[model samples]
Target: MEFDHVLSVRCSVRRYTEEPVSEEDIQKIVKAGEEVPVGHFDFKNYAIAAITDKKVLRLLAEENQALSGRGDPIYGAPLLLLIMNTPEAREDSIKLNAGIMAENMHLKAVDLGLGSICIYSFIRTLNREEGYGKYFQALHLPEGLKPAMAVAVGHTPMVQRERRFVARIPTFRIDGKE
Candidate 1:
């Protein structure tokens, strides 16, 4: 699919069908994320955990509800691509890299006719809640690495919403005059 088309159709999908994403599509999505732009310093301090296990998904969804006080934080998507960063990495770099990777994955999912949503609250819940160390360990994250965000992906029947243009665009003027 064309890049513009993918961007246009991409939306935050809160519900998904039971159809599992194909392995080939999963590979392509992961490759897109890995190809995102990292800083020139090449600080290889990030990792992605691609999870498709139903039990773990249920556990995380429950934890999210308890910690965030929101129902179905993952939105029932089948796959959870967790973006992790090492503790030693700078916070700014982590945010920048994670954002780039997440966007790439989201667009890739759309291009492949899958649905995706970037979720950071799940990571916050994981960090804030108790007894999650085992879950983190199960992911086998690199030493000191912790989840920064996630991308929930799956097959969905929901249609993408129309992109409405903003009525007024913000502008900057050198002399404080428009």
Candidate 2:
């Protein structure tokens, strides 16, 4: 798909079908994450995990619901591409890198004709919970890496439509000339 088309159709998909995302597409999405720019050229400080286990997904939804009172925080997506960062990284850098990685993966999903939504509440709740260590162990992340963000991915019944251009955010341009 063309980059403009992908950008036009990209959106947060809250509903997903039961069909699982193929491994090839999953790898492609992860590669997108891996290829993103990072702070201080410190790519080694970040990692990506592609999670598809049903049991683990259920546990994450349950835990998120318990913590935030939101039902199905993952929106029933069949896969989650989790972005993790080392604790030693600066807090601002961690967030910046994770956002970049998530956006890259999300756009890749759109390009692949899959639905995706960037998630944060689940990770926030887990980070606040006292038993969050178990989740890290369950995910088997490399030592020192912690979940920073995630992009839930799956097939969706909804069709993507080209969105009309709009200035949704306030902007001011200084054209390099007084």
Candidate 3:
């Protein structure tokens, strides 16, 4: 798909079908995440976990539900691509790099005709709940790494359609004359 079309149709897909995203597409999405630029050339400080296990997803969703009081925080997506950061990763770098990675993967999912939603509450819950070490450990991340951000991906029953552009964010142009 063209980049403009992908951007036009890209959206937060909260609902997903039972169908699992194929391994091929999953790898493609992960590749997209891996290819994004990281600040300070500290790529080694970040990692992505492609989670598909039903039990693990359920446990994460349960934690999200408990934290946010939502019925299903993940919307039943079959896969979650979680971005993790090590303790040595700077706060600014973590925020920017993780967001870039998630957006890349999310856009790639849209290009592949899959549904995806950038997830943060789950990560927040995982990081906040020190007692929930078991849930964090379930991810099997390398030592010292913690969940920073995530994007849930899977097949969706909804159809994607091009959307007209809208000015959602305020913008201002500055010139020397100003």
- Clash counts per candidate, in order, are 0, 0, 0
lDDT by residue (36-143, candidate 3, tens digit) is 989988998899999899988888777777776876667999998988888889887798899999999999999999999998876766677884446677866667
TM-score of each: 0.86, 0.95, 0.93
Ranking of models by TM-score: 2, 3, 1
- State the weakest 10-residue window (summed lDDT) of model 3: 125-134
Q: All candidates: CA RMSD in angstroms? A: 2.8, 1.3, 1.6
> After best superposition, candidate 1 residue 120: deviation in angstroms?
0.5
Q: What is the lDDT of residue 172 in candidate 2?
A: 93
Instruction: Decide which is better by lDDT, 1 or 2.
Output: 2
lDDT of 1 by residue, 24-54 (tens): 8888988888998887554478888888888
Global Cα lDDT for candidate 1: 0.79
| Models ranked on lDDT | 2, 3, 1
**Top TM-score model:** 2
TM-score of 1: 0.86
TM-score of 2: 0.95
Q: State which candidate has the highest lDDT.
A: 2
Candidate 2 lDDT over 1-178, as tens digits, reads: 9999999999999999999999999999999999987988888778888999988898888777877888987799999988988877778788888999999999999999999999888888788766463555688666777889999999999899999989889999989997
